[model samples]
Target: MKYLSLLLFLVSITIAGQNDAIAKDYYNKGEFEKALHEYKKLYAQSSSNINYINQIVSTYQQLEQYDEAETFLLNILERINYPAFFVELGYNFQLKNEPEKANTYYNKALASIDVNPNHVFGIARLFQSHSLLEEAITAYNKAKALKPDFNFNLQMAQIYGEQGDLEKMFTSYIEFAVSSPIALNNVKRAINDFITEDSTNDNNIILRKILLKKLQEDPNLLWNKLLSWLFIQQKDFKKAFAQEKAIFNRESESLSGLEELALIALNDGQEDIALEIFTYLINTAQDIDTQLSAHHNILLLRTKLSNKEDFPNIKAQYNKIFEQYGKLPQTLDLQISYAHFLAFYDDKPEAAAQVLDHALDLPLNALQEAKVKLELGDILLLQEKFNKALIYFSQIQRNLKNSTISQEARFKVAKASYYKGDFKWAESQLNILKSSTSQLIANDALELKLLISDNKYEDSTQTALKLYAKADLLAFQNKKEESIIWLDKILKGHKTEPIVAQALYKQGQLFEEQSHYEGAITNYELIITNYRDGILVDDALFHLANIYIKQFNEPEKAKALLEQIIFNHADSIYFVDARKQYRALRGDAIK
Candidate 1:
């Protein structure tokens, strides 16, 4: 008898759950009549189920039966004496356009809050549901006043933002951040919606003024963090750095946050501010590792800012850092960066090779050894030492067979063979690397393989293709002027070849590098005019539009070109970026 009774109870519970689910589904599908029927049955079986009661009331309102909803709530209120029913009754009256009756119940709901502060959340939610934002705010304020420890700033900030009262929104978010330090990122994300890349934007100006006033009033550390964030959004790295300094002093925190900020500045192309921040880190860092990293980054910054005339001084700086730090495993990145600088910028391949070889003599792991060898192989290839370069690349492939570095080394081998005009050997290696684990390497291998296969049959001698490959290698070696000359040679001779479009595109890039916008425009126009059906048309359009937008300040012309890409080349790889840029140039808010 006991086992049979247990089974019966289990079956009853399952049936009840199914009925509730059916009611919810009907409600969601807008079959309020069916939902109301189902919910009423459930409420009869379990009179204490508040969810079922709420659903029944909501379904009645959805079906435009306001009197039914109010009658049900009033019956519940008479039996249970719950204060929230007043809010439901008020909302129903408001829905019926009975403002006097609605306000009476709304005041009753507010009056109940004084006796019990916990009633505020549900009452405010009910008011907000009916679009009574002012009443909702009043209810929330009353609750906060009754309960001194409550935190309602986040809710208030959201409401203020919805009302388009940005100053109040900013202040409310700041208040929330002060009370809850861990939610700083969440607050910043909310603030980002109102600001833009331009600091002079009205919202940005308003936020800056609010933060400045907050700091003047109390000098809180939160204000400094917010100011730093705002300045970064504006690309004002110098001002951001000042704010970071204030935060560091006020909180006595580590330099890690400031280090990350400096990296942001560097990546944004603010060399002066980045250099200043890095110099500060180097001077103030107590640990040897941090100091070394700061010094290495300083060298990198100087390298980027260095001209040909400044190479000697930059080389001396690299030597000074090397002499101070020595060739330890911790300093490996600095060594590789220095070697690259020597070979590429200083034009001293032999010297660079010697430097990396010495670093390889240190007690290093396999990855470290592979890193040095990769740089060494690159230097050798740059100097046209193909046999030696192939030897180093093959060693890495043999040692780290399935590693990303191994795949990269294999790609390098294929490129080296291509540079030497050994097409068959290059194609073999490229075929193997077309499925590399590294997407970049795979893409490069596929492009190179296509280039070789596409043109190898065009000319029995492959003379023009060979010249084009050499020109590409020259561009890779930073010899842009020479690369342009070689590309012109291909253009002048192979006017009708399939490779001419690529040649023109390459020359366009080189012209842009040299700041010859008109020359770049001419080449890109040729590709678009004569080779519109070719693979380079979308590339030409995007680059041409970028030049017009950024360098020439002709946004209307840029927009026209970008639109061509959006409409004509819908399946092109540049489609998404082109559409985004088009919207941004049209002053659309970037969401």
Candidate 2:
């Protein structure tokens, strides 16, 4: 009997929910009479439900029965003690063109806030819902003044923002964050909407002045954190690093913020500031892992800035770090990184393989072992030991099934096959990886797949495709001049083939990497003039524009190219970046 009753109750709840949805749909569709009929039935069963009551009152108003809404609201106020009813009454009066009576009831709602400050929420939300923003602000401020403990800063900040008072909004958000530290990120996210990437932007300046003034008034680490975040957003990494250092000095704890700031600086191409921050971390961080991370990053930055002559020095630095940290499980990531540097830059795959094999002998977790094996596979792939590389990559997939690294390993498997001229197997692997969990791997896989798929049918021999793959492999081996030479071979032999554009784009990229700007520009221009409809046109345009803007001081040409990207290549991955750069170049007013 009890089970049967429970089933009946569940059915009743489902029906009630369905009825409410139907009533809302009808109201939205302008069938207010039907909505009112459904809402009346619901209100008869649960008259205290605020949603049903509001719908009923709104239905009456939609029917132009203002008197009925007023009577219903007044009766509810007499029985229910809900302060929001005063707002409903006021709105109904306003609808009847009775501004004086509306003001009276609005004041009554404010008076209820005076009676109990906790009543401010319902009363203010109701007023705000009716677009009575000033009344809503008054209710919140009255409650705040009446009860000192009440935290209405968030609400008042939102209302102030709605009113276009950015100064007050910034002040309120800061105050709320200072009082409740847990809400700092939420407050920053809200503040972010009003600012711009240009530090000189008026809105950005407003936020900066507010943060600086707060810092002067109170030497709080919170202000420094906010200032750091703001400067990072503006791409002023040096200033952000200074602010981060100040926060660390005052707190004397928490390396998380500092580490993240370094990564942001690195990703933004502020190599100098990233190096400075990482150096500071290496010197000051007490935790072994943090210290090791800083050491690893410093190595990477140094290598990026190094050339063939400086490779020996980089090797010495790697040795210095390994000597200090010891070749153990704790230093596994740095070891793997070291192995990669040896193979890719120093052109010593044998030595790199030896280092990884030694590291593999250590006691390591599955993920760590997989990481080491992934690097080993990369080294083998770089050396063109395709079968050996496949063995390691396949090991990762079987050991760490469905993991991101496993996906990466799968992609590497496809790449190895491509390098070996096994296009059929490569395409098969790439098709599965089209939906990879790692977006970078998936993008690479798709690009490679498309390259093979499009050109394989053009020639039975695939001679041009083989030549292109060989040149791409040379480029991966960091032999840019040789890769450029190989790409030239393809251009000479297959000028009329579809692979010519790809070869041109690849050679352009190699020239750009070598800072051979004239050569790069020549290649990109050929693509622009001859292959504008190809997949790499936007890429060629963007890189060419960057060189003109940064290297040639030709802003007008850059702007024209960026315009093409905005209007022509809307679906390009670089569209958003291009639009932003274009807007900045055009001197559009900061948002």
lDDT of 1 by residue, 323-423 (tens): 88777898998989999999988898888888898999999999999999999999998999999999999999999998999999999999999999999
> What ranges in model 2 sit over 4 Å off?
29-41, 59-68, 361-369, 398-403, 435-439, 485-508, 516-591
Question: Could you tell me every candidate's TM-score relative to the true structure?
Answer: 0.82, 0.88
Expressed as tens digits, the lDDT of each residue in 1-591 for candidate 2 is: 999999999999999999999999999999999999999999998999999999999999999999999988888988898988888899999999999999999999899888899999889998888888899999988998999899989988988888888899999999999999999999989998787677887888898999999999999989999999999888999999899889888888798888999999998778889999999999999999999999999888888778889988989988998888899999998899888889999888899999999998999999999999999988887888989999999999999999999999998898888888999999999999999888998899899999999999899999999999899888888788999999999999889999999999999999988989999999999998999989989999999998997789897999999999999999999898898778767755443
- What candidate 1 gets wrong by more than 4 Å, as runs, is 1-63, 75-85, 251-253, 397-404, 417-468, 486-506, 522-546, 555-591
Q: Give the lowest summed-lDDT range of ten residues in model 1.
A: 582-591
Per-prediction tally of clashes: 0, 0
Best by lDDT: 2
